[model samples]
Target: MATFGKYFLIVWTILFFNFFMETQAPPSCDHGWTRTPNGEACVKMYIRPPKAWHSARRACRDEGGDLVTIFDETKSNFVRDILAVNNTTTAWIGFHVILTEERWHWLDEDGTPNYTNWRYGYPDEDFWDPMVRAEECAIAAWVNGLGAPWINYVCFVTYPYICEKPLPSKCQWNDTVCLNIHETYDGWKCLKGRDGVARIVWPETYPPGSSGPIISGYALPILRSEKRRRDLQ
Candidate 1:
């Protein structure tokens, strides 16, 4: 009975510690990305040698993100500030009209055009007129009197672009806090995952009480038996 009570207490303590760690974890941005002031999303801008809409998106995807999409006024302002800070007069955004339908859509999974910041007399609805070239893509531009608003443009035109991706979990779990900041772990080496994410390699020897790999504080605990099976393979 005493042994059973001791084991139950140990299990309960471990569960409590894990829960506390997870609840305290905060969202983190990937390397070379900046989080918005409101903590909405991680964003990065490609300014040099501007590319067309499709090319810009491709470039963004290479960095594990997609062209910035603004679903609301807050996101619109966040992207606008990024462009403004960089002195980018104009840049391609993710808003566009699906050629088959006149309705506008965003490049993000939440494609519904719930919000817009169109400039006056813009979008032109030129798609309706067979003689005019369709202005399928949107660009955020600064007007002398008006603040930055979206303007429709042809998709092929080259412009600076912004990319946005969801914030990745910050791996704050380390065996020991070394005095040297760069040396996050004592003897383990850092490795980059295929998805361009950084992960700390676990050394063969581990400190006492290490039940499983510490992927992140927010991740679910992996069973020790399963981990041993994986190690064997």
Candidate 2:
């Protein structure tokens, strides 16, 4: 009896420590976002209804992203769970089939992932009875809170929308201009930022007196005279 009691106490202590540790652990991402249980991407659900698909897309763009772009079943399930939790009947995703082009594509800033999740018999284009210009948007439908399916929605209709964006890597924050160095030398790699991401300075892409290329977060404009000097030479 004594040995059994000691083992039981050890198990109870381990369980208590695990529960306590889990309770104190921070959320997977920043406060505003909910990291997917599968650790795919952070997701957010906007419950304000009556937002047109275009309006929702523009709103997401203003937030530095487009509408949520689900990559696979894991992300789809996570997003559907968000809708169920928020009781959102429908929410826009970053997809549409232009009538003229007639090929489904992602409208997100960085383009779509290869995977797709569609309700069986989806993209019918004639759902809800064919009007002249109906069913140009895609939505996650969880009106029943279970067995959610991706369905086509009218572009003008209003519904809550989901916006998804990739979490910043260790090196993305504080965004120091990669061009601030006086003279970039070969093999000049050094750690920067709190995450200690190694940044290497290379001038291979930045040609002297040429501004045809634009690097993200930096603006280097060459004067017309400089461009003309190269042209003449």
Candidate 3:
């Protein structure tokens, strides 16, 4: 039930990911995300004072990413440093204690974390409060309180948060309108369709477009852009 354009976008997205991820070079972070040394992910802090953890997560998702999820010690330390630098007391992350399983995991259910940074004697399972719902959220706690930097907090509690998503590769095109269109669609531009025909994007904006006449050497860039677009979409 998907359109041809939509299908091409999906495929390109998957292929172009390597240009930024696991790369020897990533150029730089996107407009908002902060690029790390390894360029594994782009992260941003949302220090709008406070919002319920759930609402904070939703905000991140709306921005085409999700609440921060610390997957390893390096990432954990990086997050802690961000907090320390900003003098943040605590922030929501994509994590919660799975009370039924008695284990911490990303809210996306990526499975039990290979690494953990829990505060000692915490997540007691025995911990409870009338205002909180069954102890189902975690925070990047300040390193002052009970020891470690990770702890559980009420899901409804308002707290600043971090959001993260993968960074995109640098793409330069001479056409400004084409550039804007590509950026809008996760950096993918459909220059051609799979049917060996011109597939000009934003036809109203650009007349004498692909639909008008097929040009030589146009397929490659279009195909590449379509691939990235699909993955991001």
Please tell me which predicted candidate would have the highest TM-score against the true structure: 1
Q: Could you tell me the lDDT of residue 25 within candidate 3?
A: 30
Q: Which regions of candidate 3 deviate over 4 angstroms?
A: 1-27, 99-102, 128-135, 144-148, 170-233
Q: Distance from true position, residue 40, model 1, in Å? A: 4.6
> Estimated TM-score per prediction?
0.65, 0.55, 0.57
Which is the better candidate, 2 or 3, if ranked by lDDT?
3
Model 3 quality (TM-score): 0.57
Candidate 2 colliding pairs: none
Cα shift from native, residue 126, model 1 (Å): 2.1
Please provide, for model 1 over 84-197, each residue's C-alpha lDDT reduced to its tens digit, 9 standing for 90 to 100. 788887888878887766678887644567688999998777666768646578898876656678998888889998888766643323221111112112212121233433
TM-score of 1: 0.65
* Candidate 2 regions with alpha-carbon error over 4 angstroms: 1-28, 37-40, 109-113, 127-131, 143-146, 169-233
Q: Compute the lDDT of residue 36 as modeled in candidate 2.
A: 68
Q: How much is the lDDT of residue 144 in candidate 3?
A: 61
- Candidate 3 local lDDT, 1-233, one digit each (tens): 46787768655744543243231232466776786545656888888768888898889889878888877777887887778776787888888866566667896665767777888766655545434446568888877643326777768889899888766543333211122133332443322222334333322222333322122234223334655565533
Show where candidate 1 strays beyond 4 Å: 1-27, 37-40, 109-111, 133-135, 170-233
